[model samples]
Target: MKRLLFLLKKEFRQIIRNPFMLRAIIGVPLLQMLILVPAVTFEIKRLDLAVADNDRSPDSRELISKLTGSLFFRSAAAPLNMADAEAMLFSGDADMVLVIPDDFSEGLAGITTPRLQVLVDAVNATQAMLGWSYLTSIVRDYNREVIMARGAATSAIPGISTSPRYWYNPTLNYKYFMLPGILVILIIAIGLMLAGLNLVKELETGTLEQINVTPVRRWELIVSKVIPFFIFGLLDLALGLGVGWIAFNIPFEGSLLLFFGCSAIFLLAVLGLALFLSTLASNRQQYLFVAFFFTMVFILMSGIFTPTESMPGWAQQFNWVNPVAYLMRINRMVMLKGAGFHDIARDVGMLTVLAIAFITLAIRAYRKRA
Candidate 1:
C-alpha cells in the first residue's frame, strides 16, 4: 500500500512538472466543449435558395413570400430563367432551385393541377435531402392555404396531425444531444492516450527498467500508473459537465454520484487497455499509431454522431464488445433520461467485466524483468 502511494505521488509529480501535460489536462476539454458541441451537428439551417418565377401574379408572389419567410431558407438569387437558376446551383451560390410555372395561379384557380419543380444540388446528400424536405413541407402548407382560400371544406382534407413530444429534449437542441457524447470522448482521450504515452515514455527514458528492478510488485506499479489518470479522467468529466450546464444550458437529470461512478469504471477500463497496448509497443510512436487507430474505431462505432441502429447488423453486433458504445448509452440514459442504476445495470455490469478483464491482462502482460 505504501509503495503504491509513493508511485502514485511520483506519477502525479511527473504530470504536474510537464507544462504540455498540464495545459492538455486543463485546456483540451474546455476547447472541445466550446468548439465541438456547436460544430458537430446534423441540424441544417439557412439553406441558400434560388427562385425562377415565370409568373408575376399575386398567388405566385404569395408562394414566394412563404418560402422566403421560412427560417430554413435564405433567398440567394431571383433568376429570370431556368438557365440562370441552374448556373447559380452550379456555382454553389444556391442549394436548391424552385421553378414556379407561369400557369401556377391558373392551376390554383381550378384550371389544371400545378406542378412545382425543385432542383437540389445533390453533392452533399444530407443537406440536399433536408433542404428538399423543408421546401416540400412549405409547398404543402401553401397548397392547403390555397384550398382554404377557395372555400374548400375542412372535412375534405383527411390527414393525421402529429404533435410530437420530444421528451428528454423539448427544444430539440443539438447541443443537448451532443454534450454528453462529447464528455465521453474527452474522458476516453485523457485516460487512453495519456496512460499509454506515460508507459511508453518510461520505456523510452529507461525508467521502466529501473522500476522493474525495484521491490514494487507489478500490480502495484500498474495500479499506481492507472490511479493518476483515473483521477484526471474524473476531473475532466466534472469540468465538461460544468461547461455543458453553463455554456449550453444542458440538463443533468440523474444523480451526479451515479454518473461519476460509471465514469470511473469506464476510465479504469480505458486506462487498463492503454497500459496493455503500451506493453505491446516498444516505442511511443508505435503506441500512438495503435492508440489512434483504436480510438477512431471506438468513436465512430460508439454512436456519438450517428445512431447505431442505422448501422448494418454486423456492426451493431460488434458494439456489444465496444466499451465506448456502452458508456455513451449510459451517459445519455443517466444525464438526459434520469435513468437509475437499475436502468443502467446491464451496461454497468458489462463495463465492470471489461475493466477487470483489461486490468488483469495489463498486469500479466507487464514483464517485471523488463
Candidate 2:
C-alpha cells in the first residue's frame, strides 16, 4: 500500500511538472464546453427560401407569408419565373424554391386540388430533408386552417387536435440533449489520452527500466498509473457540468452522487482501455496512433451527435461491446432523465464488466522486464 502511494505521488508529480499536460488537463474541457458544444448541433435554422409566385391570388400570397414568417425560413428575393427560382437553387443562393400554382385559390375553394411544386437543393441531404419537412408541416397547417374555416362557415365541428408535451425536456433545447454526451466525451478523452501515453512516455525517457527494477509489484504500478488519470477524468466531468450549468443554463435533474458514481466506473473502463493500448505499443507515436484509431471508433459509434436507434442494425448491435456507448446512455439517463440506479443498472453493470476486463488485460500485457 505504501509503495502504491509512493508511485502515485511520483506519477502526479510527473504530470504536474509538465506544463503542456497541465494546460491540456485544464483547457481542453473548457474549450470543448464553450466552443464544440454549440458548434456540434443538429438543429438547422434560418433556411433561405425563394418563391416563384405564378398565382397573384390572395391565398397564394397568404401561403407565402406563412412560409417566411416562421423561424425556420427567411425569404430571399422573389424570382420572376420558375426557371429563375431553379437558377437560385442552382446558384446555391437558396435552399428551397416554392412554386405556387395558378389554381391554388381554386383548390382552396374546393374547386380543385392544389399541386404545389417544391424544388430543394440536395447538396446537403440533412438540410434538404429538414427544410422540406418544415415546409410540408407549414402547408399541412394551412390546409387545416382552410378546413377549419370551411367548418365554421358550415357550422360544423372542428377536427381532432393534439397537444404534445415533451417530458424531461420541455423546450426541446439541443444543448440539454448535447451537454451530457459532450461531458462523457470530455472524460473519455482525458482518461484515454493521458493513460494511453503514460507508459510510452516513461519508456521513451528510460524511467520504465528504473521502475521495473524497483520493489514495486506490477498490480501496484498499474493501480498507481490508473489512480491519477481516474481523478483527472472526474475533475473534467465536474468542470463540464459546471460549464453546462453556468453558460448554457442546463439543468441537473439527477443526483450528483449518482452521476459521479457512474462516471467513476466509466472512467475506470476508459483508463483500463488506454493502459491496455499503451502496453501494446513500444513508442509514443505508435501509442498515439492506436489510441486515436480507437478513440474515433468510440466517438462515432457512441451515438453522441446521432441516435443509435436510427443507425443500421449492425451498428446498434456493436454498441453492446462499446464502452463509450454504454456510458453515453448512462450519462443521458442520469443527467437529463433523473434516472436512479434501477434505471441504469444494466448499463452500469456492463461498464463494470468492461472495466474489470480491460484492467485485467492491461496488467497481464505489461512486462516487468526492460
Which candidate comes out best when scored by lDDT? 1
What is the C-alpha local distance difference test score of each model?
0.92, 0.89
Per-residue lDDT over 42-111 for candidate 1, one digit per residue giving the tens place of the 0 to 100 score? 8989889888888778998999889989999999969868889989999999989999899988899889
Q: Give one digit per residue, the lDDT tens place, for model 2 in 251-313.
A: 788889999998899899888889889988989999999998988988899999889999999
Candidate maximizing TM-score: 1
Task: Check candidate 1 and list the clashing pairs.
Answer: none
Per-prediction TM-score, please?
0.95, 0.92
RMSD of 2: 2.3
lDDT of 2: 0.89
* Model 1 segments more than 4 A misplaced: none
Please give the lDDT score at residue 198 for candidate 1. 93
Whole-model lDDT, model 1: 0.92
